[model samples]
Target: MKLELPQRDVGLADDFSRSEPLRYLNLFRLTLAGLFLVAGPSLHLGSDSPTIFFGVSFAYVAAVLSFGFPDAARLLGHNRLVTVQVLVDVTSLTLIMWASGGYRSGIPILILIALAGAGLVGQGRMVLFYAAYATVAVLLENMFRLLSGRETVDFFTVGITCIGFFAIAQVARLLALRAIANENLARQRGVDLASQLRLNRQIIQDMQDGVLVVGEGGVVRQFNPQAVALLGAELREGATLGEHAPALERELRRRAEHGDSAHSLRADGSGKMLLARFLPAGEANETLVYLEDFDRIHRQIQQVKLAALGRLTASIAHEIRNPLASVYQAAELLREEKRGDMQARLIRIIGNNAQRIDRLVADVLALGRRDEALPEALPLAEFVDEFIEEFDVAESGARGVVVNRVPPGLEMAMDRAHLRQILWNLVGNARRHCSGAPAAVKIDAALRDDGRVALDVSDDGPGIAEALRAQVFEPFFTTHSKGTGLGLYISRELAEANGAVLELCVTPPAEAGTTAALPGAHFRIIGRVKP
Candidate 1:
């Protein structure tokens, strides 16, 4: 992969760049210059020309000090600055060596150090050029000494030292190249790791199931939004999981200590049933907890089953409708003719059973058409008034039984026909079971805290038993002998198709001040509200 290096100042390199090695080379030059200034005369190291030697050493120290300034590199560029420093070192040291007594004084060895430092800091064949420059300076100084008879030449040692300079330069160059390669690899790895971290966070945030990373002490190290929503509490990183969800914490403890396989808990705020699963996080005794809504999962499974069942039942209902209509027609014709009392009673039974079969067929057919819902914004108060008028025509004796308490102008978004069907099933059931008293069955609509409109239909009759509450909406489940058992089931299906929820309210309070309490079965429809 192509890697992009961080931007540097106008002329300065970034970290692990040539600037670092150049600084070290400058420090070496300064230290060498300082030593020469303190001990040169006493040691007779520059006796040939003490004036020039000490002056050059002092100048070199000043140059090194100037190079150490922060802006020096930015002003002269890294490569150009390093070149100037190395050139100064070679010229100054050659002068000192000539002042000190040629190659015999062992002064040429210092040139080798300068060449090595140049190789480490400088790029390409530039270090070789520095080595060459130093080599020529030493040879020229030796030549001058030989001609003037100032000192022995020692050509062999001088040549060997020059060779050593070149050799050290090559070795230092190789080492610098290796170090640069490693630095680049490290930078690439850092970029890759950061990208992976961001990707993992996005994945976790987008996941439908809640995920939490818990440490050894049950402290949450990381979590996503879904975790907070599923747990029904605010959770922060580094906080103990027990503070927000004690039941979940207790379940985790039970699983850890007793090896319990159960993983279900109720949310604190929403009381939604949650299914949790835990897995090791692969480090420091950390664990990964995944939370999912159990009720949602069940509904998904039920939808899949209902989809297949709807297709089969639709075809069967179509076949039964033809024969059912013929039977009903024949029963009507027999009823119209003169007949004995026993025959008339039998005919009535036939007509009643045929009509029941027709209703069952129609309910089954409704399930098949659930996917065809066309939802729209419906004014709650107006819809309820129209529904009550229509219901009154069908059940004259049950007229005025349903008290509508929907506020004016409050609108709900749902499929008009689907919502009407759902309300019809709910109100019909309420009318059948409620006490025949004024306002015995109440229909009320209110805006819920979650921005959805809740339409409740409650009756003043004995509520459903706790044992049967769970199966109230299940298909083919019923309590009455003549009940079709699919009314609530079909209603719930239609509600879901319209993106609404139809459920039995476990504990419904009285309608506010307008009527007495409805201590009976209460069914509620929650749907989106129009702005």
Candidate 2:
């Protein structure tokens, strides 16, 4: 996985180190300056020492003003300005040390404090520079005091003090470097965490199953788009879940108290059988609910069952066909051998029954291979003209087949074999049932508003009853006693495999002035027009 770190703030570590330590340094300066006024007399400093104290106090007041005004710091710019301030501090402390009697006074410790502040400025070279400068000044003062006979200096004390200043500077610089590294690691971690959160949200939003997180009192804390669609309600965050889906909210709340549970229930209005699963989430009274449409699952299972049945029958059908062909040949030979009238009639019946059985076997074998359909564009006008001509030749003396005018240049995407099989079933059914003499059955085509072409096969017989409309597409449903009953079902399956629909259409209502156009059975094949 790729990690994208957040952008680092420019100079954040440097600015932080520079400003933070300066605040403390200013406080130290003020406190030390106050101590000089309060304890100068006890140390027995002469009047000249007071002048030095006053000067240091005045310099500190200017430092206080600089700290209070942001623009002053911006004008001086941190590095150059801080360097000047540190120099002032070193010079002031040296003077204070001298006035307080050199090595005898404990004020030299303030020089060490300055060195520590320099380390917090995040500049290692500057710290060393200041430390060396302070060391030289101290040594010079000690030498001057000793040589001028002002006071005796302890060389060991001066040497130890210089070492202490450099030590403090080195240790502080190491800590500053470590702090900056920690800050960078923490910033990168925050960026990765945010990226992971957004990725998880996208995955949840795109899920097919509905997901919901309901908090206390049935308030919807979080929900995905699928939840809104599956529930058939618009779910806004922070809205009470009970308002949109009361049954689901109640089920979730009940399961939250009673441990993990799953319920299969039908949603009202939508009539979708849903499998709802609830699990406890986080702390307190919260639950995660998952909703899935059980009807879709049932359909998938049914399709698998149908496919298995098709495979089993395919093997059985091939074996049965060979025996059936032998039986049909025997019946035809027996009729030709001039048996008695009753025996001849029985042979004809046997022949007809064998033919019907052969037809059924062929349909069953076709079912096993119905899933594959290689489609191509077929121009509707030309296809229909060729089909009617071939159908008339196949039907031999049958009459009254008429084709209505179709839209020009209309085309359909379909497998030629599949489309021919479906149209043959529809036209055959219409021809077998049609009652009229001159125009018993008809074929027509039109363009529908939803970007599909509708090819209609209608007859002039009584239309199917309203109660039987829903079952017309079902397998093994037939009105004819001699029919195999798999014709419409196989046709529909083939149509669907080719990205088309075969459905019953309502016959147009008769006009008040005429009984010439009576109701009839109408079926339509709806399919996409090829680009």
Candidate 3:
């Protein structure tokens, strides 16, 4: 997964070929030209030909000023412009050297400086060309001095000066090559770091659990969308964690002070429980906070249990089912024959216990198939009416017991069979607990503010104790002797398979001007509204 970086106008030797060194070289040339114009006459610096020396110095100043303009490099191209400037510098300095008494003058030092500048800023072997060019100019000046009947030409001094030019050029070229290599290495490392940063950010954003990077003072330095969702707060960089989620911040502080590893809290907005774990981020006073949804964690554990139980119960049910059916059939046959009351009662008990075992087996089998849900849009009002009619027929004593308060046109997205099974469990539980009166069980459906549909089932009977509320949905937990205790557990599993939540809650108050509300147990299923 290679990330494409934005394009840049980078070059191979940008560090060496930049215009900064050229500007500094031009500044040096302009200063040397000014010194010649101002001090040459008083110090007898240009005794050979003072007029020509001053003329060349003035022209050198003018050329250096022209090179300072920003557009000069663009108009003539960078390399060509630098080449032209170095040529001007060499020619002007050589002319000044000739007019200022040949090799005796110190102008050759300025020529050496210009050569070194060209080597440092110019591209490739152009430095050698400038060095050779300056050598030819020096040799021609010595020839001119001898032909004009002036003085003897010193060949040794001229050769030594020319050698110095090439030596300086070679040193500058080596330095520039090393500098460019280092610059290229640094740029490649920067690109690699940027690529890794983008890839890591994408992975964090897609994670199911929330992740937060907290620095000193509980300030949030970085967070993903899941962090915001789990905390149910609007998080931003640099915001103090205490301001958005005080409970979480407190737990983090407690863990830091006491070294406790276990802690949980409820989200402020959704009221969903979250388990928090903290780990060192390998920085000074920095922590990595991971917030996991407790319900989601439970579902994962349940799925693992269901997988193992499915395989175990499958083999056991097959074996027990055959003998159990034989026993049930024999008891039924015995009941048909003439028998005493005690014998009849024993046979009846055998048949009833056999049926309970069968129902429990069927419920266990349903748990294995919880993941096979095919969700679709369902009309809430019509579905409730059909469920109520069916329930009235199935449980004769519960006729006219369940009332549907679902508004018209309200729809939900859920698996048809799963939803039916969940409602059957909830309504059957409500029927057993509610008073034997009309409209004792109320089924209400409404759209929540978060765009999810809420289906509530409540009754008018004694509600469950607060201490036992948490155990209502656990497998194999029930108050009735004949109950399988898998009804609510399977219902919750099926609800989760369809991306919904089923939980027990406080029963809602009855309508104003209607009968007073009851204190029975309430169950709600919140799921996505039909698109």
Candidate 4:
């Protein structure tokens, strides 16, 4: 909440906190050197010959030189150097006090230096140490004056002068303590924030997407560790755009301007293929480009393959239905004309074999690619509910179950017709495999704050075990009691077709304490929601 410090300095931690301390150390030396240079030549020491001016200059130079060898710096010991600085300071002020009449010169100004220095360069003890030395020096000076008899003052006058010096020193010491406390707290918070940022950066880098950050003039200011490794480009803070990844740098600039460039581009970088993407990454004023690798690209290609398969299935089913009808009718006619068990057996064989072939053809066509393009917005909740209702009505719970849901006015970017098939397959599996619980099924949708619209359909029926969440999305996976297990395989393929991912949602455990959330077998579709 402190407005003076940068965000990165506010509690951000790194592997080693020494880096922060080192910065302050360097500044401490430089600032002292500058102060001495400015004040040394003009100093008169209030009629006291203190080249406080000269000795301080020597100490500042020593402090600067010490940073080059930290071990030597420590051996020199802060206590010793600070003691030397304090002796010079207090001696100079004590002489000034004697010459200008005690407590009358600008000698009190020296206390301000002690207090501010404590806050900036050292700790409370360091300031208090200086204050104590000055206090004793002032008392000793007064005692010497009384002994000399050249100083003739009433007891009350000497008392007031003593009170004044100690009072100012006391106030200055307290201020030093407060400033030291404030400074340490601020530095600690800065370290914490730095740590949080580093963690978030690691998470961003771990993602499969190639994330790049663009800065002023299209400079790659910040990027993920993954991007560097995947691209095989070793990049640092000030590296130029072209040297890291030529195509990426140019694409980001183009996107930032919103020029007449393609929204999605498949680029061939050297020998590797990359899906170029531009998004407002992490936050605004920063653009991120995510390049999908070959694995996701292959999955997308398989989705195309599935779409083709779906179209082919639909066509072949249409053709086979005519011949299937013809064969059944001819068998009926043969039964009407004959009277032998052999003829009856022959007719049944012909019908059953033809029907089985028809079913195989049906499954194959379903496996084909989905080629429909979405050009409309559908109220997501309402659409899902309507689909579930129709599924229950048209297909009984014999092959698999289907839950009913039609949330009205819920919206998402999808082809309503195509989405119907995805829901059909997903809900069907939940009903079929899930057993002994009145065909448990559920379908729901909700708006997420993260700019993704989501739909979840779960079953209390036989749930998929935890081990399979990773591999379930691959093509040809199924656990059905019947034909191909392409139901879920195809459903996921269809959902992703419109930039939506249908994932098996993970559930929290039952009896996982009172704070536990849901743990039902669930599938979700997340994507951009309609505004």
Give the winner by TM-score: 1
Candidate 2 per-residue C-alpha lDDT over 220-314 given as tens digits, one digit per residue, 9 for 90 to 100: 98999888777887788899977888778767766766765898766643567788998778768887889998877888989998896886566
User: Candidate 3's residue-wise lDDT over 457-517, tens digit each?
Assistant: 9988888988899899987778877787889999999999999999998655677588866
What are the models' TM-scores? 0.56, 0.53, 0.55, 0.41
219-238 per-residue lDDT for model 4 (tens digits): 67777776775566776766
Cα miss at 388, model 2 (Å)? 63
TM-score-better candidate, 2 vs 3: 3
Model 3 clash tally, residue pairs:
0
| Worst 10 contiguous positions by lDDT, candidate 2 | 3-12
Cα lDDT of model 1 by residue, 51-117, tens digit: 8888898998999899878788779877788889889888988888888877766777788888888
Model 2, residue 315: C-alpha shift (Å): 8.2
Model 1 scores a TM of: 0.56
lDDT agreement with native, every candidate: 0.83, 0.75, 0.84, 0.60
- Order the candidate numbers by TM-score, best to worst: 1, 3, 2, 4
Off by over 4 Å in 3: 1-17, 41-44, 149-153, 281-284, 311-531
How many clashes show up per model?
0, 0, 0, 34
User: Which structure among the candidates has the greatest lDDT?
Assistant: 3
For candidate 4, report its TM-score. 0.41
Which one wins by lDDT: 1 or 4?
1
